[model samples]
Target chain A: MTYCVAMRVDEGLVFLSDTRTNAGVDHVSAARKMAVFEQPGDRVLVLLAAGNLALTQAVMQLLSEPAPEDKPTLYNVATMAEAARLVGDAVREVHRRDAATLAEFSVDFNCSFILGGQIRGANTRLFMIYSAGNFVESSQVSPYFQIGESKYGKPIIDRVVTPSTPLDEVAKCALVSMDSTLRSNLSVGLPLDLLVYEKDALQVTRFSTIDNDNHYFQMIHRTWGERLRQIFGEIPNPTWADPANVPLRARETVSNVPRVTGSELRAEPDTSAPPFQTLMQPESGQSQH
Target chain B: MTYCVAMRVDEGLVFLSDTRTNAGVDHVSAARKMAVFEQPGDRVLVLLAAGNLALTQAVMQLLSEPAPEDKPTLYNVATMAEAARLVGDAVREVHRRDAATLAEFSVDFNCSFILGGQIRGANTRLFMIYSAGNFVESSQVSPYFQIGESKYGKPIIDRVVTPSTPLDEVAKCALVSMDSTLRSNLSVGLPLDLLVYEKDALQVTRFSTIDNDNHYFQMIHRTWGERLRQIFGEIPNPTWADPANVPLRARETVSNVPRVTGSELRAEPDTSAPPFQTLMQPESGQSQH
Candidate 1:
């Protein structure tokens, strides 16, 4: 499993990925998931891959083959959208060749990619390419796309990132999101690839391979959790001690009584019968009343 | 879809569940995911369910049947473990009756449950029951269980909760976890059912059906996100402008260069090539060198 996230913000695009892969829990290894195609002044394309390593690596090999004059390649694609379509074609090409054989062994031809960068004529762009060889581009309304183990890291990005977020802040948010994923899931391990592209620069300016020692990531891991606990403490616990006076208590009639079957409990909670128990005796009959 | 979580702390047990159910994204409604069987002084059993609503509702219907003198039922179970076995039996019973029928329509016989409460003679115990009617009990090492749309809400609980956490604080953590889930997943919504049981009181004490209007839950929904974003701002962005002076930069030789295919890019990075472009012209050739 892996976690790859990329966002297209006003300033530029941000891409981050983790490098852990596993055959099962026992056979885990580190594999870089980022591919950079920099024509410096002309274009800077960052491709992040996830899913079956063999399939993705195969696609990478095919994409690396010298461009034929008859068709388009990542190097000569006219637009970000064209680069995406070429990636989709490559995925379909791989599926046609290897999927059926892998299917005999019960392996699905699964892979996905995030292609984002600037081409000479266009602004920064991002697209998520799918296993089915279809792709979707990022828009102002939805500024990001995440593939692979995405849920744990999603809320932070959902709350903080937007098309207008500054490039540096968006990069910070990606690392923070990755921090959550790393903490919740061991399968998505570290030594991360981070690339921040500046709009129209058409070159990679900020890139880092973050591992156990990357201080920014280290600070995020340590401080985010600590500060989270601090705020949790600061938020007053729902005052359940005295429901009658506690504003946070559900003051309405206790209509949400959990479905009580045909036990002695009831069709309705006798709210007035016994609101709570302070102490109990073995012979307490009203306790069950 | 639903989100239900249960934790056994030293003070007692905490259970929180969301009530949203959807057949697909188009058809959505609310239904209780929690059931309580309390013979008060004798025992207090709470069941939280997730998965195909039809299947879980069937399990609930089966569990609600009148207890016969010939066999054990939730109403008469002597121990918390026995109660869990009874719930498992109920799940298997439902599967035997409906799984094949559901499969005819390509519907999965999917359902899981978290059961936590106290039977008079025992201390509080928690169990997570799987679709196969198999189950595992919570231990001091793991102290909690969550079923359904659980990932978005997991990291906070992983960081904060423990067996020694106070009952109120544990309940607060459960709400916070649910808050994260609600924000991230539309499938898991409110109003929520929360129940907190005391270690020896052996009866329901703190229970709330928190909805959009519930102030405490509203606070958690509002404040948790706001504070999270606030703290996100406080965390310094990774300094990437000048890697030469930044301690956090990956100073050691970066053996982790992403697999570059056969483009003009070479096997070795020309480290001496001009790094990071501040300004560039269309004729900049070294930018790609």
Candidate 2:
């Protein structure tokens, strides 16, 4: 499993990927998942991959090799869309060659990629290429794409990112998102490859290979969790007994939960059950009443 | 799809479940996923279900009806373990009757449950019942279980929950966890059933069927997201150029990312590329150097 997230905001594009790849819990190794395509004054492209390491490596191998004169490749694609299409084609090509062989072992041909960059004359664009070889580009309403172990880290991104977000701020959000994923999922490990591309730079510029020892990432890993707990503490705990409290009030209209008494097989209305009580103040002797 | 989470702490047990059930995205409706079996001064048990709504409903129906004289039932179970075993046995019975029929339609006999409660003279216990009718009890190390659409809501619980956590705080954590799940998944919807069982209470006490209008839940839904954004803003954004800064720095020992130049098929080491630059200060004009 892997976790890779990329964002395309008005300022530029941000790409981040974890390096851990595992065949099983015991067979784990690190492999860089981000590959940059750059031409100092002409174009810059980045690809972040997740899923079966073998399949992703095969696709990466194909993309790294020179293409035939008649074929499109990441190096010469005229626009970000065409670059994404070439990637999709490469994925399909790999599937055609390996899917049947892998099917014998019952391994699904799973692979996904986040492709984002700018050609010399084109605007910065971002896309998510699926296992099926189809792709979708990011839109104004949805300015980011995440692949693999995504759900644990998604709420933060969904709330913070937008097209107009600043480049550094986007980078911060991606790192924070990765920190959450790393904490919750053991399959996704460090050292990370982070690349922040400023639109129109037309070159590989701001990039870092982050390991556990990186002080800045260490700050994020520690501070984010501490701050989250702090904020969680600050949010007033639900006050069920007091309706006038701003945080929470147990209203009369809400229905009571049904319960089956020990003497009955089916749920029976227990007239003795209270409509509401504060679970927060269990020591007060009022919660169980 | 559904989302249900149950926790066991020193104070007691907490159970929360969303009411949404769907055959598909287009076919969604509300069905209470939580059921309680209570016997004042004797025992109390709560069951939360997720997966294959039809299969879960069948199992629930089986448990609700009177059991044969030779068999155990929720009402007569001698201990919490027996209650869990009866629940597991009920699941197997349902599987025996419906698995083949569901398979004929290519539907799975998939259902899971989180059962927790206490009987007279026994410690409160929690168990997760799988589709196979086998169950595992929660322990000190892992004091909670979540079923269906769980990942989005998992990080918070992983960070905050412990065997010693207070009951109301656990309840708050559960609500926050549910709020995250609800925001990320459409399959888990409004009108949640929340039940908090106090240790040794031996009856139903604190419970609520929370709809969109429930003030406490509304506070959670609104304030969690707002506070998260506030803390996110407080965290300093990454500073790329300064290794001395607290947030991030490019280390010297870390290898540079490989790049494929537009004019080259494979990556080439470009010594010309700058080692470090500030992506955060795009207006500084030093980033492109």
Candidate 3:
């Protein structure tokens, strides 16, 4: 499993990836999942991959190979979308060559990638390519893509990031998102690769290989959780009784039933009815009435 | 899909569940997922279900029916573990009745539940039941259980809640977790059911059916994200190319990099190739080096 996220903000693109892989819990190991293609002053394409290690490596290998006469390669693609298509094509190619053999051992042909960056003549663009060789680009309405072990870290990104977000803020949000993922999932661990590319720069402006000792990330990993807990503590607890208490949600109100009494036992009955005792006793024998 | 979570803290138990259900994006609707059974003094059990709606409802119906002989029913169960087994048994019963028929329609026999509360003689307990009619009780190390659409909300809980956490803090954390889930997943929506029980109180003292208008939740939903973004704004941006950068990983002191030239582009290619980019560059030249 892996967690790779890329955001396309007005100022630039932010990409982050973790470095952990496991065939099973006992076979866990570290594997970098980021790849970069640069022609300096021309095009800067960064890819972040997730899923089966073998298949992802194969796709990367194929993309690294010189383009064959009939095949589209990432290096030769004309546009960001073309690069995305080439990535998807590579995934499909891997599927064609390995899916059946892997399936014999019950492994699905699984892998996905986030392809993003600028190509000299065009604007910075982002895409998410799936295991089935399908892809979709980011838009103003949805200016980001996340692959592999994404959900744990998604809510923060959904709330804070947008095409209008500042470059620095987007980078911060990405780190916070990765912090959350690291806390909840063992499959995503440290030594993060973070790349922030300014719009039309066509070269990496900010790139850091953040290990456990990375000061900013360490502060983030520590301070964020503490501050979150502090804020959580500040929020008022639910007012249990008092229907008229009026909470933040104005649409509905709590029912004014007597709070359950620990000592007030439910009805006891003879052999025919059976003696009863429980936390929620019926208010009365109204049903029988 | 639904998001339901339960925690067994030393202070007591906290259970929260969302109401949204959808067969597909266009088929969205709301339905309550939490059910309560209280015999006032002897026991209190709350069942929060997620997964195939019909199957979950069927299991609930079976649990509500007259107790069958030779089976451990929630009504007659002794310990929380036994109670969990009863729920599992009911699940297995439902699977036996509907799984094969559902399979013909290509529907999965998916249904899961988080059952938690007090049974007078036992301590507050929480258990998560799976589709296979197997279950695991929460322990001190991992004091909570979540079912269906869970990952989005998990990181916060992993960061904040523990058996030693106070009841009020747990309640607040649960809402925050639910807020994150709601933000990320449309399948989990409002009209949440929240029940918080105090330890040794065999009764349901605090229960609220919170809708979109609920004030406390609205405050949490609003403040958490806003505060998060604010905190994000305060974290310094990654300073590019600084050897003595405070944000750099403490263990790896890098000295060769030049300071970032603000708004100025350097025309020279990097003289020293960093190993990070070398591994990421898919080109054969970099690979051979």
Candidate 4:
């Protein structure tokens, strides 16, 4: 129902989220899902959420409330890990209060969050928190986290992103990923929230609320598809005439293509027959063979 | 898990399927999923399946057994529609025999099929049959069907394949789609079965059991990813300096990027807050204003 992705590259952190939410096909509406917490020179934190609107809003509400003097809150958390724990605690708190009532109506308590930023003393870090109030941080081998409708746009990110990727390039990749998702899935729509944080900046510098009219996103939507088609054409089609010369030749030892029982079919029928009779009837005398 | 896709184009039909099947990550094995029924100069039918391995194999077994004197079989079906109906009927029969028992074990009666080919008097047809034994035929607007782990590879097919696409190109698109799927999902693996049928041939003409050593598929596996990264690089990165010159500019009318309440934070807190308190607290004097 949503697409939110965040990357932790060597240069910085990038966060992006879509605005669309729906109860069903007919009840579609837009809601911004990116939230920023800043303390200027001290720390900067960004939270992106996906899942049930009510549950996410509830978690966000708990996170936004003033903390009791002795407790930790997003504003006073000393480290990125602590910030994530605070988010997880809020999620669990919501689950504690709302899960039972929501379960009565058959609504599963579901929500996920991407929390990424720098606290003055630490390095930029990114974490994905689950519906169950647990989380995992990004690592060198896995430099990103995506929540919601993630598969359609995943291949490209899996191919292009690494910890070494530049901040601007990572930002571009995130938008491109979002574009692919928006095209393939109707549930994720525009008016996006994109935030690019430079490592150690300790403040939000580059942020945008992109709508249908955004020129840069418009170019990506058009150019990515067109260029993809262009490259697809540029690749040579498989040549069946000479299997020996082609890369996708049929192998020698493997069995031939499977063909069902019928006149003029070459491949043998599967020896492991079913326990019951099939709809296929052999020609009069052929069964004897 | 498996990835099976079939396309219906003006030139002919293309069907591609992966061989990997798994009871769980620890019990991975390979089993061919494409089965063909051909009557040479009369008709040709191909079935590609995905879902519970036992259920699909059971349905396939029922289709392969000897038909009784009175019923229609793959050999006797007059049209492609009849062929799809026969397959659907086999699926329903399997459900009747096994669904309840499987339910006791909590295993779903989940399986789906892509059936396509041509008969002497009719045009090429493709249908996607669901677990319930109901099916829907492919149309010009949506000319392909994919079952099991399909989302990862869908965007490319959505952009490139259409009814007017040529046979070889369709085959290439299918492979590229499969390649994307293989990259993102560990459950779908190689040693793929590919079958290409030309209109009016009424028999299997081009088929390949492509393994990891298959050169053409190797070329596809390498070149596609390389060229994709190349093209991704060719697209200029978004320039943040001037929104007017770029394609991803932020719109002026929409609200500014969201910022949670905190000292030195510029953007306003969401005015329509949830009915509960948020973890965000405006600093001492800041909240009173």
Candidate 5:
């Protein structure tokens, strides 16, 4: 398991990936999942990968070699779309070479990548490449892509980020997202590789390798939880006292009892009975009463 | 699909379940996923279920009826463990009656439950019963059990609740957790059932079927996000300027260039190269520079 996320905001792009890889719990190890193709003054491409380590490594190797004949390589792709296509094609190449052998072992050839960066003359872009080598680009409505163990970290991003978010803010959001993922999931571990690409910079300018000790990340890990708990504490406990709480009204209407004490009677409503009394049991099973 | 969570806390127990059930995205409808078996001052068992609606409903039917011969029904179960085992046995009974037919249609015999309450003499307990007729009890260290679409809502519970948490606060935490699940997953939806059990009171005293118009819940849905985004915005953005961020130092140590421009040479440990620079590609592919 892995967790990688990339955001394309108005000012730039932000990428973060966890380094832990494991064939199983016993085989856990650290492997850098971020690859920076920094071609200063021309283009900057950031690739964050997750899934089978061997498969990702093989795809990366294939990406580095020359593409057949005039096909574009990552280093020379003129547009971000073409660059995304180049990645999908490389994934397809690895699938063609390895999928059958992997199937023999019952491993589903699972691998995914988040590719995001800028090509000079084009706006920053983000794309998520799938195991099947098909891909989807990020849009203004959803200007981000997450691959692997995504849900635990997603709500924060959904609430905090948008296309116009500042580049540095996006980076912070990514780290907070990663913090949630790391705490909830054992498969995604540190040190993390983080890269913040300024829009149109055409270079890898802001990058960090955040380990457990990185001061800012440590601060994030501590403060985010403390603040969350503080916020959680401040939210009022849900009140059953409110009239809009139907079950309370139903209980009132159904005399003083909280139990429906009969099976499926709500479907055949008694005008005298409340609108909802759903917890059901057979009348014979009322001995405890 | 559904989301049901039960927590055992120092004050008592908390149960919350979303009513939405779906055959697929197109076939969504609402069904109650929570069942309350209150024997007044004797026992108050709450069952929260998720997975195949048919399987869960069938299991519920089996649980509602008398067990064959002298076997105890949930109404007669002497302990919370016995109640959990009864639930599991009921699940296996459903599987026996339906699994083969379901398999013919390629549907898994999937269903699970969180059973929690107090049985007069015992302390408040929570157990998760799985599809295979086995169950595990929650402990003081991990006081909650969530079934179906659990991950999206787990991190918050992990951070906020404990066995020592107050019952009302646990209820609030459960709702907040459900809010996260409902926002991140479409399968978990509105009109939630929330039941708060007091330690030795045993009868269902606080229960609410919370819907869209429920004032407290509407406040939660609005305030949780606003406060989260406020808290998120308050956190400082990550800085690559921090020297503790190794990638920044690596660039300084490896001359002014940001690209490594060659294959996996970091292993050779050029003392000149700052300890970690694993992103690699062939030297021949440096044309973009």
Candidate 6:
């Protein structure tokens, strides 16, 4: 399991990836999942990967090699979109080679990547490339892409990112997002690779490889937890037995008191009894009269 | 898809479930995913279901009927553990009857549940019952379980929950967790059912069917998102380019930057060395010149 997130904001792009890999829980190992390809002054491409480590590694290997003259490669791609397609093609190449053999052992061809950056003349762009060698580029409306163990870290991104967001701020949010992922998932461990690219820079600007001892990340991990609890403490707890005091009217309509007495009707037991008793009445809405 | 979380804290149990069901992206409808069977003064069992809605509905129908004498039904179970097993058994019963037929049509017998509550004379407890009809109970060390579309909402709970957490606080955490899940997943929607039980009460107490219009929930929704962004803003953004100015080190000892270029040499490289040059030699212990 890994968690990789990249954002395409108006100012630039931010990419972050966790470094833990595991064949199983017992075989956990550290493996860098982010690769930076910089032909300084021309292009700076960051690739964040997740899923089967072997497959991701294979795809990375395929992409690192300069493609034959007739084939498009990230190094020579005219635009960020074309660079993303080159990544997708690399993923497909790896899949075509290994998917069948791995399937014999019940391994799904599971792997994905986030490819984002700028070519000399193009705008910074972000994309999420899939196992099938297909991809989607991020846009202003949705200025980010996440791959691998994404959900635990997504809500924050969904709430915070916009194309107009400051590049530095998005980098902070990406780290916080990664912190959340690291806490919840064991497979996504420490030693994170964080790259912050300023639009049109054509060179890596901010690149941090954070391990457990990194101060800023440590601050993020601790502060986020303490502040979350503080905020959680401020929220009101449910009013259990009181009806009139309930916070919401619809909730007050339900009483916490139990309506049934040992499966024996609490009301008139005659067959002529009101048909209302059998209706889907929540215990919260009923009180023993 | 669904998102349901149940926690067994020292004070008691908390169960929360969202109410959205989607057969596909285009076919979405709302249906409650929580079912409560409260035999007040004796037992209170809350069932939160996720996965195939039809299958869960079937299991619910089967469980709601009077239990056979030999079968340990939640209504008559001696302990919370036994009740969890009964739920598991019921899942198996449904699977035995429905799985093969569903498999014939390329459907899966995919459904799972979180069953938690207390029975008279027993301690409060929680259990996660899987589709295989096997289940695991929560312990003091790992005192909660989540089912269906769970990952997105997991980080906060992972960081905040413990057996020692107060009931009200845990309840707040569960709601916050649900909020995260709701924001990230369309499959998990509104009109949530929340139940919080007090230990040894042997009766339902704190319960609410919260919808989008509920005031308290509206407050939580608004406040949580705002607070998250505020905290996100507070965290410092990465310092790029000039590592010397940053408080934290930005490079790792076994850095991946070298690997990026190394892999390139393993493949056909540049006939023209492009503009950026990989530094050919580095003094021992130094990553940058």
**Ten-residue stretch with the least lDDT total in model 3 chain A:** A273-282
Over B1-289, each residue of candidate 5 has an lDDT whose tens digit, in order, gives: 7888988888999889899998889999998888887766677888888999989989888777644546677676789998899899889889889999999999999999999988888898899999998999998888889999998899999999988888888988888899999998998898888887889987777776777756667778899999999999888765434232333343233222234352332123222322222222122122111
Query: What is the per-residue lDDT of model 3 for residues B60-139, given as tens digits with 9 covering 90 to 100?
Result: 88877654355555655778788788889999999999999999999999999998888887788888999999988889
Interface RMSD of 6: 7.9
True contacts reproduced, candidate 2: 0.59
- Candidate 4, residue B266: CA error in Å? 15
**Per-residue lDDT of candidate 2, residues B137-174 (tens digit):** 99999999999999999989988889988888898999
Interface RMSD of 2: 5.0
DockQ, per model, reads: 0.36, 0.46, 0.23, 0.29, 0.26, 0.33
How do these models rank on lDDT, best leading?
4, 2, 1, 5, 3, 6
| Per-candidate clash tally | 0, 1, 22, 20, 0, 5
Per-residue lDDT tens digits of candidate 3, residues A97-163? 9999999999888898999989988899999999999998899999989999899888888888888
Worst 10 residues of 2 chain A by lDDT: A280-289
- TM, every model: 0.90, 0.91, 0.85, 0.89, 0.87, 0.86
RMSD (Cα, Å) for all candidates, in order, is 6.5, 4.8, 8.0, 9.0, 7.8, 5.7
Instruction: Estimate, for each residue in A1-289, the C-alpha lDDT of model 6 and write its tens digit.
Output: 8888899888999888888899889999988888877777788888888899899989888887755666666766688888788888888888888999999999999998898888887677788888998898888888888888887788888998888899878888988888888877888898877777888888765666777666667777888888887777777754443443323344345423222223422222223211111112234453321
True-structure lDDT of candidate 6 = 0.75
lDDT of 4 by residue, A167-227 (tens): 8788889999999999999999998888888898887767767777666778788999999
In candidate 6, chain A reaches a TM of: 0.84
Docking class of 6: acceptable
Question: Which 10 residues in a row give candidate 4 chain B its minimum summed lDDT?
Answer: B275-284
lDDT of 4 by residue, B165-195 (tens): 9998999999999999999999999888888
DockQ of 2: 0.46
User: Cα deviation of A244 in candidate 3 (Å)?
Assistant: 10
Interface RMSD score of candidate 3: 10.5
Return the interface RMSD of model 5.
9.7
User: On residues A1-289, what C-alpha lDDT tens digit does candidate 1 reach at each position?
Assistant: 9999999999999999999999999999988899988776778899999999999999888787765566677877788898999889999999999999999999988899999999998888899999999999999888999989999999999999988899889999999999999988889998888888889887777777777765667778999999999999888765544333323222345434574744432433334333532211112222321
DockQ of 4: 0.29
